[model samples]
Target: MFFIMIIILSITYTDSYANSAHSAIVMDVKTGRILYSKNISAKKPMASTTKIMTALLALEYGDLEAFVKVDKNAVGVEGSSIYLKYDEEVKLKDLVYGLMLRSGNDSAAAIAYHISGSIEEFSNLMNKRAKEIGANNTNFKNPHGLHHKDHYTTAYDLALITRQALLNEDFNKIVRTKRWISEREGYNTFYNKNKTLNQFKGGDGVKTGYTRAAGRCLVTSATRNGMQIISVVLNDPNWFNDCYFLMEEAFREYSPEKVITRNNDIKSFRINNGKVERSYMIAKEDIVIPVKEEEKDKIYIVFECNETYEAPVRKGQKLGKAKIYIGDRLIGTTELFAKENIEKRKLIDIIKNFFSK
Candidate 1:
């Protein structure tokens, strides 16, 4: 929860702030699956959520413990900032907290310079990483997500980027943190800017943004019932509430089901010319998938294998494949392996097995 947070808005849209998203999406955090979307691919200026990429680059490339000498060019950056001063030194990690919790544009600048020498260079890194994460619709012109004609991303792209960022343990800790006190200097204490962390159940991360051009843009994430959902709203007047609604809708509609368990016996199949009467097949990977309760009947597992395999079949030998389907969509597939060795049948072997039995 954001025990302390201050709201900053580009325009006061309080009176008619409902369903004002130009683009939006709700994605499953674990699977990179888009559960809901509205104009998800339409690119628009994404105010401060761009800091997600900035913070990510810092976490990946910069040493959090390293001291960053705030560049003169990095000072007094437009929009939200931790108010970095020229030549002031701060820890890379704390800057990230400021970047995420406070939406510090200056913190983003300092980290950029510290990591890539110039904001342009850092923006290149950001674009590179965005592509690596499959954010094909994203193009970053700056680190802070300030309004720029070339600086833009889609709701789908933001969800993909944030999903990858959330995978990092340190990145997870930093964004989810409610409050962080700086040990260095100047406005040392910061509160979260992501108010969804305070207002919504299980809400932890993400960021908030607004610009005269971009309107209200937000990325929010929450975990409920062991399912983590991420919502992105761009140019929304009611960003927080909309994100909450999307996450809640996802939770209500989808729940995880264990479709396959690793090394667990899946089925018994006929074994021809084998000492054993049957051969057991086991799954090699665990597959837990989120599906709607109503679709449970539609979900089915199909096994593809020969009716019988001529032994000797060794333990762990690949036997078949099991595919999971949700209606017509094939969701996942796993190879089936022999659970135990089954030697070729022989008269002497049959007599020995009979005596052992």
Candidate 2:
């Protein structure tokens, strides 16, 4: 038989990702790892991406089935809208769907007013929530992103906000939906503008935005093989393509590698004045890390704990930590625990232990 040549082309992140956005980032949702970055921390106008926070807060504060009366102030808000009329009563959940799926400025205002009594107060809540989620660089001046001078967020901060929002089951369900019908009398239907939901195989959600000042902005997320990846692109003409490519690159190059398995023996520690001369320490949970394929070889673990533990060790007691590193970069740490109990040695047992030693 003729020989079949097989070439395993090793691809690096630098070669695969060449984004053109003014600011961009790709993060592993589970581990909070930044897979790729290009000016991710630079603050830029986010356009309707601000609705993500608005939707999150609405979900947190408003009862989905409760009726929300649209304030007159919310009726004529600028930019994209769901055409909500003044005094129109709609379910709070439906308004959120309109806000997220339709990028409705009007809906954003209604939800903001319903939840916090005014957009200004709602914005203060937004800033507070942003800080709680570690989106330190983000500042929200309005519920809807309309290019206000004081409103801006970094790609990294937006990703953090999205990550926090994704933790809520209802929020996750709403964003991933492709189409939804409001509970209004006419059954108003709204379609999601996030193109990645149709373009990519596992595309789920996030949001999309555009304005004269912000240009084009998009936040896209996809899940595959038990891993979810989130990507953001700001002020890019080819935002969909950039996000798609970045997500694909992340999936192809990196994977969640378990550095330490839960309850697996990590290292042996000497036990002083105990029935057992030694005790084994193990990880409390799986320490999974997102790492490049080639970078796997560079991964290493360092153990930190007391040289010897005193007797009366209890099972699952905290002993130390295992710090995982990849080429000097600390990826993450896991708590090490005693695998089993080691009771204090009695005088009779001490004599037997000394003789065995």
Candidate 3:
């Protein structure tokens, strides 16, 4: 029986998943919110999805225009290769195309050696980057996602890494390309093995992977109707089918909602002791949430206020919290602050004002 549930794509995880693989996670790229999660914290062999982090580190540390010499160690290193022979003179850009598009083990090693002088050193960089990106549950033992007893990550962690990668305009451009041809020594070209990049509509890219141990694995991203969703599936017999279905459900059910805008007056409240009787509070910045198209009206916002406050409340002072609710569930929260200041009303001033009255 095929089971499907609609997630509003909100910041909170909705009950919209079924038994599959070891772990799975669907996240909104903008807010870093998990729209759906199942064992997201559980770590497992992520296969080639590890390349997302590899690509990220390479983009940051490895220069794309720099040329790299394919070393002997990078040659004949197991699984999903761009088939690079030893001593190949290829630009880093071409190697990345091979790395991300072809999921080339050869390209991964070439990148590692060129950037860090050795694969072991590059793996160290990968682990450092993983920690910097807030992926505590993840660890990298290699640049290529070839099955390593020690290299592993969770679906949620993969989502976290991809979201960070997408923010790098350069990284996004590389992943979205349909095909890349590299000219070196002679003219060798490699086609992207990511079938979803061409087969599915709005398929931007990401990467695909597999091993005898890490069964059909994939990380997919797409944008439709102004909504972008990222899906990570590991160890599934039908990774593509599951991802497609999940994306369809996400875009079909939800759309982006602007909860508050910067500098916009939120609400007015009375001050106990101040120069101003009432002050209008405005949002410091905009807050947007993803919600079901049908349930847009159900989205609710509540203002929280401090019970008491003294005079001299400075502008931008935290006064309370903004609680966001959707269908009785708390999806997100924002800080509420005083937009302006208030002065103390002294007793002498009050007495003089009363006598004059």
Candidate 4:
């Protein structure tokens, strides 16, 4: 009786939470699988979310500890900035902090100049990286996400960029950090502007932006109970409340599930002497899913193997594949292989086996 009541309560909670988001999405950061989404693909200009890529390119290509001279081009660009002076000397690391924490427009230009020799060239690099990452709706015209006719990205694309950024050890470290102070002759402090870091429970560091043209845009990430979700809100009247409610909904609805693990052996079938035998399989890599906790037991796995394999099989040879499916959706797939070599029978043994068959 207790078990039945628990199941009922769980389902009700999932239903209510799943329907509670206004333009929200929950996805596995590694696999890019959408756990839940509402109007996530709608195209919109992403304000300072552009910094994730700017910082990414700088980290990948620019030397962090190298000294950077604030060029004339970087000195007077409008909008928010740390107020860099012309010909001022600052380390690349300090500028990155300014770029991310304060969304410094001058720092963006400095990074752009350092990376591509000019803002025009760096903008090209941004576009190239965006396409490479499968952000189809994104086009970056400026490093600072200033409004341009062509500069736009959707919630889904920002999630993709964030996922890619998280893969880089350096990029992840920078975004997750809430505060930074540069090692200069005098103390230079940069505080992370992501209000979620100070306001929300379990709120990890991320980027936030606002402008008259791009109103109250924010991309937030949080983790709880081993589940991490990234939420993006654009042009919301009440951006903080909307984002908080959306993230809370995702946390309430989705629970982390181990989709594939190195130790979780999968069973498969092999043909030997035209007879089927049970063979075990394992994942080449671990996979995880963000799903409702109650749905964990209902998850189903399918092991799709080759229709047939001739004798003389060797270990680790590619046989076919298997996948886990929940309803009609594919959760994960693993390559199927022979656990051990199965040698063909000797001619005499084959003759005897044929006669027995």
C-alpha TM-scores of all predictions = 0.77, 0.78, 0.73, 0.76
Tens digits of per-residue lDDT, candidate 2, 102-172, equal 99999999998999999899999999999987888999999999989999999989988887777678988
Q: How many steric overlaps are in each model, in order?
A: 0, 0, 0, 0
Candidate No. with top lDDT: 2
Candidate 4 TM-score versus the reference: 0.76
lDDT of 3 by residue, 68-187 (tens): 888999998888788777887888888888889888888888888888998789999988888776777888888888888888888877887898887677877888887777876554
RMSD each, Å: 8.2, 7.6, 7.0, 7.2
lDDT of each: 0.82, 0.85, 0.77, 0.73
C-alpha lDDT of candidate 3 relative to the true structure: 0.77
lDDT of 2 at 109: 95
Ordered list by lDDT, greatest first: 2, 1, 3, 4
lDDT of 2 at 350: 80
What is the lDDT for 182 in model 1? 84
Q: Could you tell me how far off, in angstroms, the CA of residue 287 lies in candidate 2 after the best superposition?
A: 5.1
- Candidate 4 lDDT, tens digit per residue, 1-357? 000000001112344434333355555564556655666777777778788889989988999999998888999889888888888889999988888888998899999988898988998999899888778788888899888877888777787788777667777677777788876545378888888887888787678877777777887777776566677777766776667777787677677777666536666555565333445555555555666776677777666776557777776676766666656656555565566666765678768877999
